[model samples]
Target chain A: TQLLEQSPQFLSIQEGENLTVYCNSSSVFSSLQWYRQEPGEGPVLLVTVVTGGEVKKLKRLTFQFGDARKDSSLHITAAQPGDTGLYLCAGAANTNAGKSTFGDGTTLTVKP
Target chain B: EPEVTQTPSHQVTQMGQEVILRCVPISNHLYFYWYRQILGQKVEFLVSFYNNEISEKSEIFDDQFSVERPDGSNFTLKIRSTKLEDSAMYFCASSDRDSPPEAFFGQGTRLTVV
Candidate 1:
């Protein structure tokens, strides 16, 4: 089974601070996605990186896919209270496989 | 933007009772999936549906769990008998053909088995 591991299970920082969360795996993925979930709600997709060494930016959030496609990272610049949530990374292999493996998730708290 | 929608945001039922969790994926989506997250745990894949049948399922999706697209837009997950361990937040997701792997998820239903 493909497994994704996330680092820094919990993080707390003052607003305007920058933080980086990492997702690593031994299995190479065709694509990787990042999601942010609020309390009591389902996760909302933040971004998806499909190619090795790919980088996508959504405002203050920057997502990078590893050169080997076995890992990814999410960086938040000038974090705000609104950025606080459970961050998740899911990895998808070939299209025919038909399923994705999710990481344990990192909970972020940005105090205003 | 279109998003998956799930019914009965919360359900509380007695053990051994049958329950159906309903989901209506985005209108243009072709791939549908069901996932569950136990409290404070990572989300786990339950099943994936495409072409009117199950395409894949995880080991956790045992004999007691079943999925069906009874109609054009509705995908349902049925649990034959509930147990205390079954309690969790269930999420439904869908993706359009243009990017089948980029899925959008619903708000989710919290099931509490008593």
Candidate 2:
């Protein structure tokens, strides 16, 4: 079973549209990270949020962690084709070896 | 910027054959990791190594799987017998700290078992 669940497994939108993707889990995590991956390449780290109820923004992309630390969301405003890629969320639990648990990922496609 | 480097961008091996994937993590990093991703699927964590020992492993990592840091800079993963299900892109990663720190990844080695 997947440790983390991501919503909207796939997304397709036009330029200038706004969209939000979600990651949820029943287990609380000490930290959560988001990454973006293009074709034929490894995932690139985007941001890491450690505190619950925390919100961070990278230009047009906004990330928020749930108050309970069991969920997170990524929101993009005025999306462009450059934003098209697979978005992944991974979490590290408070227990164990600090290895990450990853969600399936959300594939986004923005048509220009 | 420092980067993780993996060898053999792609490999084609027969089932029941042994294959070793090698990685050179960023210098001065304290932790090393191996992750895999099947086509059209999420990245799965396989194992994490620290202080010359395996600190964590996933259920997917079976007896046939083994990891080693033979030298100061190289981390290697060995599959004693490859299975059809083992076909995937294997990524090597490293981090400077153990506390969910920023992990840098290699381009990944695509393994094809037939």
Candidate 1 per-residue lDDT over residues A28-60, each given as its tens digit? 998888998999999898888988999999999
Model 2 chain B weakest lDDT span, ten residues long:
B96-105
- Write model 2 residue lDDT over A1-112, tens digit each, in one string: 3399999999999999999999999999899999998887888989999999999999999999999999999999999999999999999976647589889999999999
| Local accuracy of candidate 1 as per-residue lDDT tens digits, B1-70 | 7889999899999999999999999998899989999998999988888898887889999999999898
DockQ of 1: 0.62
- TM-score, chain A only, candidate 2, equals 0.96
Per-residue error (Å), model 2, residue A78: 1.0
lDDT of 2 by residue, B10-31 (tens): 9999999999999999999989
* Candidate 1 CA-lDDT value: 0.91
Which candidate has the top score in DockQ? 2
**Backbone clashes per model, in order?**
0, 0
